[model samples]
Target chain A: MYFLAIGLIYLAVGGDPAGIVALLMASGLGGLIAGFAWHFGRRYGTRVEDLQDSDAPDATGVVGVYPTASLRPIALAFGTTLLVLGVPIGSWMSMIGAAIVASQVLLLVHDTDD
Target chain B: MTTIDRKPSAPTVTLGGDDPNHLVSIDSVIGPSGQEGTGLPTTLVGWLTTTNHKALGVAYFVASLTFLAIGGGLAGIIRAELTSPGQQVVSEQVYNQVFTIHGSVMVFLFAVPFGFGLANYIMPLQIGAPDLAFPRLNAFSFWLYVIGGAVMLFGFAADGGAAPFGWFAYPPLSGASGSPGLGADMWIVAIILTGTSGTLTAVNVIATITMLRTPGMTLFRMPILTWNLLVTAFMVLVVFPVLSGALLMLLADRQFGTKFYVPTDGGSPILWQHLFWFFGHPEVYIVALPFFGVVTEIFPVFARRPVFGYKGLIFATLTIGALSTSVWAHHMFVTGEVVVTFFALTSSLIAIPTGVKVFNWMGSMYGGAITFEAPMKFAIGFLVTFVVGGVTGVMLASPTLDFQLSDSFFVVAHFHYVMGGTVVIALFAGIYFWWPKVTGRMLSERLATWHFWLLMIGFNMTFFFMHLLGREGMPRRVPDYEPISNWELWNQLATAGYVILLISMVPFLIAVVKSLRGPANAGADPWNAYSLEWATTSPPVEHNFEWIPPIRSERPVFDFRWINHDDVGAPGVAEAWMAREGLDDRWLPLAGPVAADVADDANAASSADSDVG
Candidate 1:
């Protein structure tokens, strides 16, 4: 919402298109957050957080299912490093990076299903 | 309030019990731990793939400290060269690379990540959350940072050395025609990766804080540090991507024949400033606020008082974050294209909130039982030096003054005062305060005292003279300077201060090594601090806390201890207080032996008091 306001103000002031784009990008991020909040608020309505008089222990217990460990993040990082490095180096390197990224992403999705 | 006077029926949970070492695993209480799996084995591979926030935080600390050493070495070279005027230490080209890499490495690799690292380790603990909302994403962000930083440093060994156009990398200097080297491209790639890493981390922080806070840990009940971090993450989310975008445009101009910053080819060089400073100005607060949070946390613990005007501090932080975005044009005033008055107004307005924070810290410490531990010492150093920096910052906000001091050592002096003087100094305070908590060993007080005094003297001596040098029209970013009246003396003094500053790290290093070599004697709650982090053991176990006390206020741990009358050695007092406060029914079956011992102690204490009367 703040980002949206800033973007509108910049537009009103006849700011640069590039500057406006940046502000709009920020607004998009803000919207994403708002959307997430709305979705979660509806899904898990009136949590202890919403109740002012709630006790701390009421919020305790398993918060969420957190990943204990995963190797896909490392693979993803490696692929990204290679992909970015290829930008300055060569197209062949980029091709290999893209291949690794595609394979690892597939494996990640499969892992989630299992 | 919903009347809880009627004892609500619920299963009782005992806190610390008779066994003394009875660890209360939340997993045990809340059913299956959900930890059993054929996931990555607990080995080197497990560490590599670790999504644990604490482990990743340690990695951040180690990596950032290494970069700090590298950056400090480059600074040593720059100071040594400028010690006697003419370029006696290295060639002008080397000098340029030195300062450029120094600035880039310090700002990008060291300062920003250091804050994130602290946040990673401590923020979750403070908020009573078990872990960040997206642990896998957090691990990915850490790896990205590590890889990105390594790639950036790899530029030093490139054919044409590293990018020498300064940290901001303003074009046409950073353009293909100007740099024409792979080093510049590598720097851009590295920044893009790190910027992405920062943005993702910001998302994770925001998500964790918003969604994962322990029940009863309402937003307002949160510690000041958490509030500051929330604001900092918001700023990072907004600005870092903008920086990434600008960098990408610069890369395109170099590689894809785009003219985003090519002034000769229908591009505006000033556009780069607008884009960069738009991110750059808030980037200052991005680094500073965490440390500001650090000192705010420290002041209260040592002074033994709640933060003065806690809500006011939060409001001030929000105000500063909002105003920082608008004041970026102040940096571009000399370009003769900006609305100087508007920027000047916004820039000066920022000082009011910052001033409110200073008063809050002072008010926190005004009449409390203040202790000048190593943390307090460095925090005091932060207070005195940050005021100087703040005053100079306000002075520079004026367009007329900024025009005069533009590109001068005064500008250099001003930022260093804020960044190095406040941020770095407060970082030391945090290191000292939290070292025991992190390492489970106490740093030697004697060594810490030496470290504090040496650094304080050296830092002030070094940057203070630069202000005078700037006033006398000594330009910054130059390899050599003509030996004018007192210019030589100022340079000599500054260099001498640098040497002292360099030497001061010795004791700190020694203290770290010595403490680590010793036993883990620093118990949990070493200073009896108020925050939730101190509630757990020093170097908390895998799941953090065994049991968190009821958080009725921001200082839950303090309240717990107060109810127990732990200072009076009265154990049963906690039960009595809980019963009186109508909390007994909620958490009964109070540790039997411990309760008995407490009851005995309370009786003994009462009798002793009566006898004295």
Candidate 2:
């Protein structure tokens, strides 16, 4: 509706048919969104705004899970990057970076806990 | 070091069956936000080891800011060298390295990661999810970027100075024969890491947006900022792979024996251009879309109205995203290998969507109570400069125009207007608008306004004249030029402008320091903003929202305000909204009143059917 409105205004002011056509295309896009929204709502029930006047329900609990952090991935990625960097530098640096990457990747997959 | 497993701490989620009418308390088991995730350390080590999205966001912010400082210093050196007609400040080799690193750091180190910082922090919160879908993947992505960037820049200390080739690092020049040093190799490897990180980040973002949206928050109902990031993330997935492949091919040529880009060995250096710009054009938008999202998110709030044409903005965003992929060849216009008509038209057509956004912003401000605060000022600056930048861009889309302006200061002015003008300035807008939300204190509006004004003056003075210099055929990437052609005057002017731009950062730095020490009194809805992030406290708690506000509409808070509003487009909307919602001071978790409405309609239909029976 907004696009069509703008298109109308553009037509009234100047004979830019291109302007009108572009906006109409945009309006079609707007229609596409509304169409998607309708389908989405029918598929899954619409969640509404929280009204303070309402009462609490029977269920209430939180099981917020924070994944435990591990350094293996970081170590492996960094080591591999260094090994790549080392290829043009020297064989020794390449060997060291490769060893670190190998050990870290093994630790990342094989060693469950860190 | 404490050993820990990646398991949900007993119960993995906070399940709430609160009556669809009441707010569900969301503050149950999610430990304090900004704190480490389950089984992660709370100490500094947690910052390094944790997969929590918020921590990663903060780390990206800090790292990127440091890179900005480095990049900004390099810009100062470049300007200083150009202030006069001679290479007085630094050697030519040093100058080349400085500019190369400046462009690389700004794009790879600062801009992209800056988006990552803001998105990783805010995207999950907007979707009402705890964190990104793959927490470990997010952590690994950040590490890849950091390690890659660090090794790449460490080329400064290598046998030869850093990679002196431009950020593009075009082949033949960048091939083993031309660049025999380790610096170029380091640059190649670093880009690979950055591209890999990009893929990883995009995957996690796409997953979170697709699967983790709060119940009832349909695709259309998601905030425009999230929408922008969604498009940006998808672009990341599509474009990064191409660049990574190209870089690896370049790496293969640079490292083991290969002649992929070697001109003598049945290779064409021009092949690199096709591969690079294919990703490069989208990369420009990748840096841009978030800031566009920022301006969209902020414009409506300060204008004291719902965003003008929400659906229009989303479509425009999508349109820009789609066209961005096809327009890559436009950048190769002067290369003569491009289909001029196809690219020129597509490039010109992009103006329609971009212009639609400009019109939407103008319409938003029409007859509205306008506040010329810091964020708004920067946003206005962005609008003016982006239009100018965009107009010039269209002119260049014409192959004839591009042939003249290619590699000139005009191109520099155009890009800087978009990048420095829109991207960086929009980042400033995000910082100021979200400042109070991030730190529980208001930034001094007085200092913020001063910073905005200086930035405008300094920024324009620096680049606008470059259009003239470019017109005069002043080629780029030169350290010194002959004092003839009156180019010295323009160079001096541009250099002065760069200086002013540099000085403009001081007030902002001061304001940041003062804000940190000032007060902790900014409320959740400082701007009375419409998005979900404002539904929580200034600095959100462990679980972000104590109760996840119901996904009522795209503007949840706005919908909450205008619930009883039968009369739209009235000034008393905010006042009246506060009166109704403020009656009960406690904010419960948001739930649907819509479901009830639907149920009521169904009930009425059933009753009518029964009566007829």
Candidate 3:
């Protein structure tokens, strides 16, 4: 629909009929492919049912530990540090001090319980 | 006496349900038969509210392909103009803008996202995790991409129109006084937003890969795709911000009275170049490495052999990431601000690692039962084209050669070979390889074959002659050329190639539509694959799995086939371990503040341990 709309718009604007035809063909074809890809993807792609039951365990008393949920914040903090370099809160010393404080805060949380 | 090193204490263990120490089993989570699977969600909720790494991967792939088609259409416009190159088509300025947006859209919006999408969807699943550490942030990052990309394009619909300053949006030319339009500003803001998305997503993926692996899924044991993604994520964190910073400054310069680039106001335009390339060079690898990973994934699968020199491949991947950062000045060899020798040396050295990878890929195929599946064909196509591109890159890397070739179509030709020829081919290969996994149905092999041939032929026809044209002193970014130049023949041939390429894409479309309506079914493990992903059904349900199955090797499905053949029933002893091993219910785990918190937690945990000892 988007392609056809664009093609019609092109024609309305006095674009070459042949060019408009070519473009519509390209877009219509691309959209068809994408739609089918999604359809088949939905049908044949991995589904939840194939996996083992979520609540049951084959083994006894085995605990798994993933990273505690604080990793993104540290990364954001680091990003913030870089962003702050663009500003002049202080001289180079201010930048250094801020970096130290951010690093220390990151270090103080989320120890590897896993 | 040296203190004897000891491993850290393992987590607590319990039998069957919610055991913290045991992270592998199928019976505990995601109950059987109509119960919600342990993955993410399978229904609309799974797609809308869920956060599985695999689902995200599929989303990225779909998004990237849409942009690819859009960018390809833009390319068609560019080719049409250059067909005869005499103002027979659009005006010179429109032509310039078309090609510029064409390159920028393809490289930044299309190609860079291509690898990231694949990596996001597949990396965690391949490594036996259920979801990314930062699920919400992942969604946020993707949203940012959509918003940024749209804003950039929307600039076209604006009063001044889309940016025509090329992908780099080089300053002076890009400035308000010079261009005096919102198109460039749109490009600036859009890219800044996009760069932010890239940076955040990189941090998320890196943290997920580093901290969220299942039991025994160590770094070395990870799939090549995951490893490449890891490197890519790291590079994204390092490089994208530089681009973001540059874009912000550029925006300020253009919008406000900021003098970041205005020389009379104590700003140097060359500084903009430095900042841009600082991100630009690595941005190339950022686009390429994931394809390298995809190539790595496809080669062994079709060849029916394990990857050769796995460690070497990993090292080469890492080397490319690190070395890529130092070689940014290679693009600026003619600018004279760069230390020519330093950049030249760094640039030449990058070839060694790239060569190592080529050798390893070939080595992997040696003595193996190689089959020319469509995916493998594309992968092999990448190997051939990328090598040529690499050669050109090496040539351009040289200070003298680059001085000669800089700003010429030669550089354009080289990059198209590398970025367009290689990465785009690999992307097609990845689509073919994972299509069944994503769609639960197979694409028409006949149509796939047609698509491959046309893609290969048309691409070469369009790009190969550009090298010659560029060598003949035709520079890029020009709309019309004098009739006396010999560039006409090559340009004509290239335009014809674009037409052919457009034709080639048609069959794939037909195949997609035909297959979707047909009765083809892709059962789980259609290719007899090795990997946890194959264990699930084709087109996995909402919430990936009904039960979290046990994983021994990286190829859990295959291992399941070889080992105990019994069906691990729902609520079996394995469920607890699987839940522990797999992802949480929600997808975005660490995008918020997980990265910062994890380090601190680790530090606190370590100090407590030391104090105890």
Candidate 4:
């Protein structure tokens, strides 16, 4: 939505607005995809219970125990916000945000439990 | 899982003798003198087709040293040319070729092979494994490297002279109109072949580390050196394929008039930078990070303390590896095409993990009974020099500063500080540390000290002034400069430093000669080290270790001593800590056909794709 607004503003404000809008749109779209992927993975991937049995030390141990659904809305919101902000800066930021989203999804959904 | 007593107290057994540990079967033909020398079977068959990892390691060491000398000579030529500047030394064209080849040889052949020489010779023994996971691929990789190196050097004698393009070979410059010669083509072919060797070697090492550990040895239990190599192998796997692909595409452009990089032909020059840095950024780590591991491994041993924050150091290693890819675009900040904040943030972000490593090393050294042996001296030197290099690296990672320093002597100074100063220094440390094991003898500490001081003084003198040169706005890769450039005096100083560094090699050579000719004095553990490799005799037999024990920790053999003898507080606490992380013994799961199959499949796919195209 923020990306759409940026596009509309670019269209309405003038001076390479199309290029700006296109850049924003591309970046925005990338971020959205990434966020969704992360959300999905977080929802379905490895859970706290899965890691409980292993002795492997992980950074996410603290965050692991939280219920997936409980974390989802917040993650989605955060990712969306990052996606919106990342577009204006350039492709690299959007890609970073996208990676974050993707990794989140991997964390959420790449579970052995099926 | 199996115990065969080829203990230090017993007479040496042939590799393929009646001992159950012997599998390759070359022990029977070892002549009477073989007890004192390489227990190599007296047969052409054994030398050529034998899959002995120890033999392969010897080959790597020999090849690495030969390339080191060649690369050093190339460096001398480059420094000589830059001495006074102007055409007084060599032609501009010839200088271009010389430096290009020099950089290529030093980075690809010298520094890289130096690390691998240690890894190849030591990793399996340290892990309590008999051989690497894919021994044939190890041999194949070594051959391919030699073949590729030879081919690239052959380009020097090509009809148009060697490749005059910079080592990076950025496109448009390397394109048909820019190069118009086969020299560039030879470089492309050679490096692509080399990249393939790297990728294969990486895969083999990774597989070996992951799958072949002795029982009870987990990932966290691996030694710091092995852990570093593990991370480096993964880095190589991720980056080398991209380099291979990029070079292949470049080769296609040159040979078949494809316009992948020719701007007039709609090729993007920036694309080449992207591709090159994709490999190039990680390539720096590929060369330096192992030395970081080398020095890190040595510090604890000499300091007589456990490696501080072993787990944190492991995390830092992995983090550095992952973050390395994201920061490649920092190299492009001068071009202004890169996303500034994105790269800047990532570049600065790397400092966090690097800082962790520095802290860990310092912590390891703190309050410990430190002994500044020759190896210890080099290790300490690594800490100091690498910190300076790392700090400067963080500074350059900023786009704001990078814009001013790119293509300047500052860039050269920065890299040489890390690569030449830190990595090479650490490599010497590793050499000094392991020379007794590899050769069954000890290097002279007196000569080693001489070597160390000269290297330190000469290296700093050569590169320290370059900071000023860059500040004064001198450009790099130029063969000649006018008298008025103000870089003449600094250039002469830097050149003199190179000469000093060259002279420093003499003491090092003398030390090596003294070690080989001196005595067979290094017992199983002359340093009283803790790792599994030291549990075996100096210059380990073909199978390395005889009794394959279930590894309870990273320091398996060291653990045995502690458990059996109740010596938890060893003389060198760090060595004990390293030994405590030893792995259980397992045979490397090397099936030669697997690599052969993969190469075949890849070749088939490429040929099929070509046919379809």
Candidate 5:
């Protein structure tokens, strides 16, 4: 927001299109702040700063632990990297990336019950 | 809940025992009824997928060290190229890429990531949190950093190797026209990814610090390092978005044909400068603030004094962070695009807050029981070297001097003094200070002292003369300079200094390796330090702590010692108060030699434990 205002000030006084990056940054961070603020505020409320109100110093105590040891994230990383690189690399790589991503998402959401 | 045995006399801080200063009740958080945390899995897969903050911290530490080695190797190449005069090493093109990659790696991979790793390991522990607010996100952030690093380095395997336009990768030069190489594009994508990783981590860190502190640990009571990192996270939140936003536009112009920087397209290259430096100036502080935090913590412990002006230091840190954003244009003094007056003024304003921190540190050691331990030795070195950096920095803040020295080795020397000198030195200090706690072992002080002297002498030898060389008008980023330029002797001396730096690092490395292989006997609170992290086991449990002593002051361990022993602190305070109040010290125990006495006792305990073993 500070950078945004500066860029606009610089441009209004003939500094030229510093506005492009500034506007992009403002939007990116604005959205992030809004999302994060809402989530953090709703979730923690005023309890965030009250260290005394927190649970005991139990290392093993936790609120939640999701399922673990899956290959989905690895596949996701691979596919995402490949897809990004494919933009300047080749269309064939992009196809492979797209395919891998689709399959990985399928495998990811599949329940472990079976 | 394990019981850490203190000296037979010093009251033991046990898990279930009733400690008078116990801040939080065990029944509320650590009693028998609380369920065991989803403890770490035994398998490598579990280690890989685990959200344990400590594991992630270690992963970061190891990865960042590897990156430093790689970056250091690149620096070696650049040094080789500039050894005496002629380009004795690689060609000019490779030279460009080498230096660029060196800067990019050092900035993105080495300093910042290393800080993150240390903070990740220590912050949650210091704040007495079970884990970061979002653990899965923490793991994800770590992996993203790893992948980002991998992608950046992977650019070397490409046809053109890596980007030659430098880390900032300025427009026109970095665009499709100036250097048409896939390496540059790869640099763009890699930087974007790295930036993304940092941003995500910043979000996690900010949320963790703000929302996850244990009860009783108020903002004022947070450890200096946590406070420093908290400020750093906010700076990251504000500044990195600018870098990412700028890089994205630069990327479009490079790969997708949007002229955000092409002059013909009404896009000034200066736009890149503005955006980059806006992020870049605050970015160095993002790197340095952790150094400040570490030194701040180390000085107080080694000096046996409360940090002078705790609130003053916090306000100074916030001031520096705010002022850091305004001074970006100081870097642009030569560019002629910025309001020189505004930048110069803001740039000079930074010194006021920075001076407050410096005075606070010096004052912290004054009138206190100061010990020159390995960590303290390094911190003192930071003060000496960083002062030179800071003073020279104020000189550069003047646009007149900047015009003369902007592209010279002078700026190089300044940053190396401040950035490499302070950040790296403070990092060594942090590593030494925390090693006992982190690894459940202590580094060899004998080897550590060797590392320190070699580094100090060599670092000063290398950079101190660069100021001279810069004053003589030696240019930076050059593969070679003519002998007629009268720079040969100074350049050789500078080159020798780099050699010394490399040599000094050997003992440092040896010390680390030796400790990892040595005994795991560093009991918790080896330094008997004050932070909440020290209240736990040396290598803290799977989560962090089993039970924390109540937070009475910023220095919890120190306060606990005072409450329990009364020999080291309370009597001393009482004596001062009595003298000030014109009363007798009749009721108080003798004001014993504080740190030395405790240190002797701790040493005796350590020796006895060894004898038993």
Candidate 6:
């Protein structure tokens, strides 16, 4: 909302198209955050953080399940390095990087299913 | 000579219900025994794949420090070249590349990432969260940073020998006609990747601060460091994307014959400035705020008082973040195109919140028992130098003044005072303060004293003279200068100061090396601190805390310690109880003799209440 208002103001003040586009993009990001917050608030209801009379222990006991370990980050990083390097190097490197990235994404989804 | 055990003390209280799945008993969470089934492997592969925030935080520190060494080495070369006059060290082209790479490495790789590193390690502990909201994404961000930084350095090995167009890479200067090289292209690609990493990390930080704060640690109740990081993350999320976009456009202009910055071809070079500074200005606050948070945390701890006007500090931080977005055009004041008055106004407004913070830090120390530990010493150095920097910043904010001083050594001095003097000094303070909690060992105080004094003297000597040099019309980013007036003298002094600065790091490195090789003498609550991090072991367990004390105040650990031991009427009794409980004597009021006074005041208050009844 802040970005939206700023964008509108910039547009009113004869700002450049690029500047306006940047402002609008920021507004879109703001909207995404708002949406995320709305979804989370609805799903989780009132958290202990929101309560006035809550103790520290009230919010304890496994906040959420997190991964113990995974090789995907390093693998994905290797793929990204290649993908970015391909821009300066060649198209073949990009192809190989894209394949690895695709595989990592599939594996991530498959792991989530388990 | 007492070796502080890293093992957690047994749980003394229990809470929540008896349901096995939902059990929140203190015993359930507090010890290595409880973590038997959930231990992360202690192997190289484990480190590569680990999504633990603490481990990733350590990685950030190591990578950032490595980059700092590289950047500092580049700075040494630049200073060495400029020490005398005409191109004494490197060619003009090599000089440009050297300074550009130095600026890029320092800002992007070292300063920003160091803050994130501190935040990653400490913020979760401060907020009582086990890890960041997105643990996997956190690891991914770290790896991306590593790759991006590696690629950035790899630019020097490229065909054209790195980007010579400066860190900002403004306009036609950065175009194919200006810097037609694979190095520039690599620089762009590296920045885009790192910017993406920063954006993703910002999202992770924001989500963690917002959602993962433990019960009673409300947004306002959070420690100032976490609050600063939360605001810093928001700024990062908004601005880093702009930088990434700008870099992408620059790449397009360079490679694809785009006219984005080609003014003759219906494009404006000023557009790039608009986008860059929009990110760049906030980027200043993004780096500085976390360090400011570090000092804010330090002042209260060393002064042995709660942060004065804590809520006001929060509002001040928020105000700074909000105003920072509007003040980006102040960097372009000399361009003669921006609304100089409005930009100037927004930029000046930042000083108010910053002043509030400075005063609040003073207020925190006023009329309080204070200690002169290395962290506090460095923090005091930060206060003095940062004020000087802040005043200069306000002076620079004025369009009339900026028109004269823009691109001069004055600008260099002002930012270095803030970034190098303030941020880096505060970073040292934080490192000294938290070394125990991070490593489960104590850094040498004797060495810390030498490090602090050398840094303070060296930093001031280096940058303070640049103000006069700049005022005398010496422009920055120059490889060599004419010996007109006192330019040569000031340059020589600055170079000399840089040597002192270089020497200062020696003691700090030794301290770190010695501490790591030494025993774990810094027991939990080494400084008898206020925050949650100190409530746990020196180096916390795999899951951070075994048991979090009830968060009745921002100073949860302080409240827990004093309140639990309130039954002891005197210092002797307190000592007896500590000894009976096998507590290290070092934990007994390392802040000062003030703890005994506080205990007396508490006893008096309780007895007076009984008399009234």
In TM-score terms, which candidate is top? Answer: 6
lDDT per residue, candidate 5, B564-588, as tens digits? 3445442332232223221111111
Query: Mind giving the per-residue lDDT tens digits that candidate 6 earns over A85-110?
Result: 78767889989989888888778667
Where model 6 places Cα greater than 4 Å from the true spot, the runs are A1-17, A59-64, A112-114, B1-42, B564-613
Least accurate 10 contiguous residues by lDDT in model 1 chain B? B1-10
Ranking by TM-score: 6, 1, 5, 2, 4, 3
State interface RMSD in Å for all models. Answer: 10.5, 11.3, 17.0, 21.5, 13.1, 11.6
lDDT (Cα atoms) of all candidates against the true structure: 0.80, 0.73, 0.67, 0.67, 0.75, 0.80
Interface RMSD of 3: 17.0
Task: For all candidates, state DockQ relative to the true structure.
Answer: 0.34, 0.13, 0.02, 0.02, 0.19, 0.35
Q: How well does candidate 1 reproduce the true complex, by DockQ?
A: 0.34
The numbered model that scores best in lDDT is 6
Give the winner by DockQ: 6
Per-residue CA lDDT of model 6 for B1-613, tens digit only, reads: 0111122345333222343223232223333333332223478998898888889998899899999999999999999998998888999888889989999999999999998897789999998877788888888888988899888888889998899988999878889899988888888888888888888899999988887776667677789999999889988988898898888888888877889999999989999999998899989999999998999999998998888999999999998987787778888888887777667877998999999999999999998899999899999999999999999999999989999999999999998998986678998999999989888899899999999999999999999999999999999999988989999999999999999999999999999999999997677767868888886666777767655655656777666556434432112322333232322111111111243444455457768988999
Mind giving the per-residue lDDT tens digits that candidate 1 earns over B546-588? 4455566778666665652354322333443344343322321
Q: In each prediction, how many residue pairs overlap at the backbone (N, C-alpha, C within less than 3 A)?
A: 2, 16, 114, 21, 10, 0
Model 5: lDDT of residue A46: 62
Q: Considering TM-score, which of the candidate structures 2 and 5 is the better prediction for this target?
A: 5
Model 2, A5: alpha-carbon shift in Å? 31
Model 1 segments beyond 4 Å from truth?
A: A1-28, A56-64, A112-114, B1-46, B564-613
- For model 4, the stretches where C-alpha displacement exceeds 4 angstroms are A1-114, B1-50, B484-486, B548-550, B564-613
lDDT score for residue B83 of model 4: 81
The segments of candidate 2 whose C-alpha lies over 4 angstroms from its true place after superposition are A1-63, A90-114, B1-42, B562-613
Query: Model 1, residue B399: what's the lDDT?
Result: 89
- Deviation of model 3 at B295, angstroms: 1.1
lDDT of 4 by residue, B96-163 (tens): 89888988988887788666766677887776565777665576576667767776787788778778
Q: Where does the lowest 10-residue lDDT sum fall in candidate 3 chain B? A: B1-10
2 against 4, candidate with superior lDDT: 2
